[model samples]
Target: MSNASPSVKTPLYAQIGQRIGQMIDAQVFRVGQRLPSLRDLASQNGVSVSTAVQAFHWLEERHLVEARPKAGYFVAPRSRRPALPAVSCPPRHSLALQRKSRTETIAVFQPQGQEVTFGAAYPVVSFGGACPKDPLFFDDDRVRVALARATRIHRHSLIEYSDSPGTQALREAVARRALHLGCQLLADDLIITSSCIHAVGLCLRAVTKPGDVVALESPTHFGFLDLLESLNLRVLEVPTHPKQGLSLPALQLALDTQPIKVVLSVPTLSNPLGAVMKHSDKRALVQMLASRQIPLIEDVVFNDLLAADERRKAAKAFDQDGGVMVCGSFSKTVAPGLRLGWVEAGRWKDSVSMLKRVQGGPTNVVLEQALADLLSQAGYEARMRRLGALMKDRLQEARGLINDSFPRGTRVSDPSAGYTLWVELPGQLDAMALFQRCVAEGITFGPGALFTATDRFRHCLRLSFAGAWTDVERRALARIGELARRQGDAP
Candidate 1:
């Protein structure tokens, strides 16, 4: 909410200066026009005169505004900057998916030192975890209380293994929560798993054997590709729009030609792309899947992060014949440490349950009960609100930086929700090389090649602004932009 960088290390004055810089770049103050007086500016920004003075001085140093004698600073005339990057232009034809060598990816091992990481898609340390960060998002005391209550009440079940289909209380809780996504789920139909991805894997395994083709958004979560690869399933990459989500016509083409056994998608707040399917489009997608008798594994892990209520509706909401299976986890929304996920397998509930039981069995009963308590509590919505606001602020800051600092031809995504940005660098810059360069500078970001089965996002990359956008992260973004510019300049 505040313009302050959230990082204690970044002084309030510096943030104020950055805010003013942004305004200037937008041409808020014309050249030769006197700027607001120091006192008024301070009052406007809720800062002290000293801070305002410091901000103006900082601007003057950059030659953006000049301080005249006795008069306040005036905006300096500057050449017009280039336009932002354009939307992606991937090849029209689908290609056979290939396995990537492990060395191609810069694996995100545990941080060793003060590395500025934008490489991994996970939330930053401040907002890190599958669940909302404790204290900042979810109340730690509340979680502990729920855990204690669950333990006290279900102490006898501690020694016994959990139900293969999961605890009844947790299933009921999940059913209640599904209403928000416009899904009317039965507790009996739900199956609990170790995590959301675990549920997705089960759905994949149940629906298709190895070598069967699966259709997915072209620029999907790298994790999805990893799962598909491990499953030994061939992938048919469908063309996904930056904002509208999977192209239905493109998908229809894939369905007509390829032997796609199932479709795995994150319809709401899709990973990397952050594309949200329109409600009508969602219905159409469900109908199309039903017509083809294909299954949909909808990942609603990031659905709660959408600002608009309409945008949070999952594709499963439109399912009438169990063609859509909803997969979710609390890692991104509630608490990551919980490691709990759920799946409503539609018609394949029995199969998914069997696979889950055979593969990994049930999750911890106490943890499931605790999560149920957390979900049933009133604070979950408020926590999501806080998380969404924080993510929006971080995203806006990052998008602005990318627009201003990145190479002239760099195209960036303006997703409706979530913290990830899909960047298409101009001049055919190799994202892997960019990743290596950033790593050398103690900075890391997700390269484009890692996200797909084919050569779709070779010049693209993904950046997550889910963490605190401190001076270090900001500098890292600028450094990436500089590197991108240099890469574009190279022969």
Candidate 2:
């Protein structure tokens, strides 16, 4: 078990912290519940009190527990005990994607991009960013060395065009990674694209023509909406739980009622909401789609960020008849600069491969080789753990601030892992109006209106904590809440 654990290379106290973490996750110890005294834990585990203290400290750093002056240790409340956002039930009818003006699209799309300044000389603090930016989350030196080694090794390949379906080494590397998601994919079936978004676009193109209907989670990733619009596809948004992911029953109903050609979802650590489907539910989702012959474009870009191996298993693992097209990239969890993403197209392999060649073509083989090297290296899981902990600390702290500073009745999500929080402000407080106010002050977050084609989420916003968290950033977050509070009862 130790050999398999990402925390194996960590200190012994940290390893013990893992055990306590499992307990916490399983609800053997409820949130805000007190744990045994340090002495009792030491006696139970046959270690000294000093070691137990260190173990508790390790958990504290990860925000799994808190130390009080005389209250001993208690399980830290997730998202500071805020009421979770209610399950979303978007309008049942499938509707064509609305095309926005380029200027409006740029205003919303700019936040999700990696660039710091969006052509504005004035500085803006973005809370809508999706990529992790802090250096503490990844080992930059390791990435540099890997890139250099791959460059030296594959120098001759630069003059060569990478194979249409990607290099064998990178494909094999992705197959190996699929194992972590409980998938035993064949490397031959994989096609490397520019990014996960690109892979999804290819999948959509391969399966459906323009004006085809697709069913996706409500308050879905805004990027998906943008892609659907570009493809001229219609969408039906299904009801989705904040923590459990897409509602299968709603999806089934949509399939029966609408001409849904595909289902696109982020089953594990879904963007913005960070929902991880239950294992049984994942299997059910695959089976449901397979029975209907409806293709599923499953996005697993954030799968590796989850801590538990069992929980990391993807819905694609349950695919039996090639109905699931699983897409992923390491840019979010590993190297953001690398424009590398892969997809196993299941039954639509040939179609997706052809689309890859016809569309943007293959990525740089040398960079792919570097990404392969990075993926196959040891301590990858440990790096993910580091990222998880860093995000955990910040998210908990942000939740606390939201609790104190946001409008009354404000609700936020409690994700298993990842860097974003879906905040539901008071219903009367228009989140788009709030976003405009924040932007005027040089601050920005994903307005709820941006996430959906409909207006259901007009009071919500997705706050991202992936970037550097300085005092200025903290104050900016607090300021957003202040504005929301002021506008809580406004018309």
Best by TM-score: 2
Model 1 TM-score?
0.81
Off by over 4 Å in 2: 1-80, 101-123, 489-491
Q: Tens digits of per-residue lDDT for model 1 on 191-304?
A: 999999999999999999988888888787878888888888887777788888888998887788778899999888887788888999999999999998999999999998
lDDT of 2 by residue, 3-99 (tens): 1233213566766887898799899999989999999999998899999999998788657899988989999986546799999979989888885
Query: For model 1, what is the C-alpha lDDT against the true structure?
Result: 0.77
Supply candidate 2's per-residue lDDT for 80: 43
User: Candidate 1, residue 416: CA error in Å?
Assistant: 1.3
Evaluated against the true structure, the overall lDDT of model 2 is: 0.85
Query: For model 1, what is the alpha-carbon lDDT of residue 135?
Result: 43
**Ten-residue region with minimum lDDT total, candidate 1:** 121-130
